[model samples]
Target: MTRVSDPSAPRIAIVGATGAVGNTLIDLIEKRGFRYRDIHLVASARSAGTELNVDGESHPVRAVDEFDFSTVDLAFFSAGTEASRQWVPRATAAGAVVIDNTIAYRMDPDTPLVVPQVNAHELDRRPRSGVIANPNCSTIPLVRLLKGVEQRWGVRQAVVSTYQAASGLGHPGIDELKDASRAALDHPDETYPAKEFTPSLAFNVIPKIDRFLDSGFTLEEQKMLQESRKILGLPHLDVTTTCVRVPVVNGHSEAVWIETHGVVDRTELVEVLAGLPEVTVHDRESRHAFPTPATVDDPDRVHVGRVRVNPNNPRAFWLWLVADNLTIGAALNAIQIAEELVERRTL
Candidate 1:
């Protein structure tokens, strides 16, 4: 990851620089020119002292405990939840504002779960704490698109099902799917059960995502239901979700049914989505120009397609949206929030 443009910040730190999303965070921070004078990189203790390049120069990873946050202004925490939980407060307490990508603080009433294109104002509103939580990758694009709709015309209910990519589970999950697929291909009968997922996820889709609750909703499904309403600031909005893990290595796709307060045109709806910033509408049914993981593997734009009204219900419309699970979903969102903080003088 290369740092772009101005090298003017007093101090900045990127915790967990070696992981998939963490590495991507550095790539974007550098790509967008969120420059810093002292750019500190941290990882687990074992990964300390390993060198990473910024602006083509080597920078060694530091132990988190050894990192002095007294002079740091902005810190991007892309580590796992437990690491974020343990160190984020320490950094923030030292006066560095934290933009965390983990789910650690997302549901906290005081901590705003931010998506720049959606609830950027939530980050703009000050007088709260120092840390900000980035929304889940699966939730980011889906919620961002929905937020646009909700602001203009109210939406009453939604039924969403995700064709989530293996990347959502991180590196281990991706490897698990790959290994399972290889075994299935070789022996056909001696297939491995999913190492990260509950069922086999190689060339197969698992209907269950995350741990199931007694309430019968898997955690992933529940996150979609809950995070959508929270990010849109319509807590009472009815939303149902079914999250499935697919064999794709990157990008998560969704099939969504939106029930609005009033009837709306399918064509106009596509137009609205097309016009929205950071979103690309691919609504072509004749040639099947719908959003798929292969088509939008690494794009920043959220691809939307298959715009159609439900034949049985005119008020309800079905649509498809896809986004890169690693970048746009988590790292890019976090960096965008950091960019917002700089623009709004929050950091």
Candidate 2:
């Protein structure tokens, strides 16, 4: 890999500095050592002035309303959808590249939905609106792992069951689990459990992730369907997803079943996946190893395992995949896109 350097390096700002994804963004940016003239951390006025250490120095988080994008060259927006909806246009109008990690602008035909490993070149399109939208958390890893298969078998359809960690729903998700657990153990006689989740998440499972759409699928499930197609440039691809919230804290896992245009053997798919750098294949018999969150939790590599065809379906393949939704799904992809931009001389 060649090191990227920007002689006139531009200042990079991270919106939502106090959020989980925001903290991950700061770590990834410094770890890659990307060239930047300065680093600015911005957040809501409530979080402003909070002290955080960056590159060994302590800096205070600034208020979003006080930021002057005129001086920043790039900004990563991990704030909620409402904030992105309100501020993205202003930052873009000021000539600063905005990589938004929200549902607000992802479906817009004018904004390219990017997963660096899958549809990074989509960023080369130079959106008329000037913002690049990152895919939904669960969709990012799934799309990349499927990329190798799509190259050979040409995936036609998919069905995925997700075991999403509580963090996928943000702070409220975590708090709900904590509150429910506390109430259950402490106040056993209490009538109601925690109220953050629609369903009790302490010891139960949530089959629904987001709001239900007219098609009867949750918003998260539909995001997987639509975002995967857009990132893969396969508009007509069929996708069905069951997104669930699990008790796990950080990593996201999926069981994917894909029908391809041509026949594919399980071993052949494993071979192709093992060879991909971004993908880690864990199908060992002696050690009884198969990809899991414990193995591929924080790395950019997506772990793939349990490769097998449906017992009767010869034209399809089934597999297990895992990755850190925080790293590969959001922060790392954003950093990789910036690096690619510099490499392609398109930054």
lDDT of each: 0.81, 0.81
For model 1, the local distance difference test gives 0.81
User: What are the TM-scores, per candidate, against the unseen true structure?
Assistant: 0.93, 0.93
Alpha-carbon shift of residue 222 in model 2 (angstroms): 0.9
For 294-330, candidate 2 gives per-residue lDDT tens digits of 6665477888778887768788887888888888878
Candidate 1 lDDT tens digits, 1-347: 33434544436788888778877877776677765667888888898989998767788998887888886888889778899899998988888888888878888888888888877888776526688888877888888888877865679888889889888877888888888889899979785865687778887888988789999999888887778778888889888888888899989998988988777777777778877888888764342687788977447789888888877887888888889988888888888887777788666
Which stretches in model 1 have alpha-carbon errors above 4 Å? 1-10, 125-127, 284-287
Model 2 gets an lDDT of: 0.81
On the 0 to 100 scale, the lDDT of residue 205 in model 1 is 88
- Candidate 2 Cα errors over 4 Å, as ranges: 1-6, 188-195, 284-287, 295-298
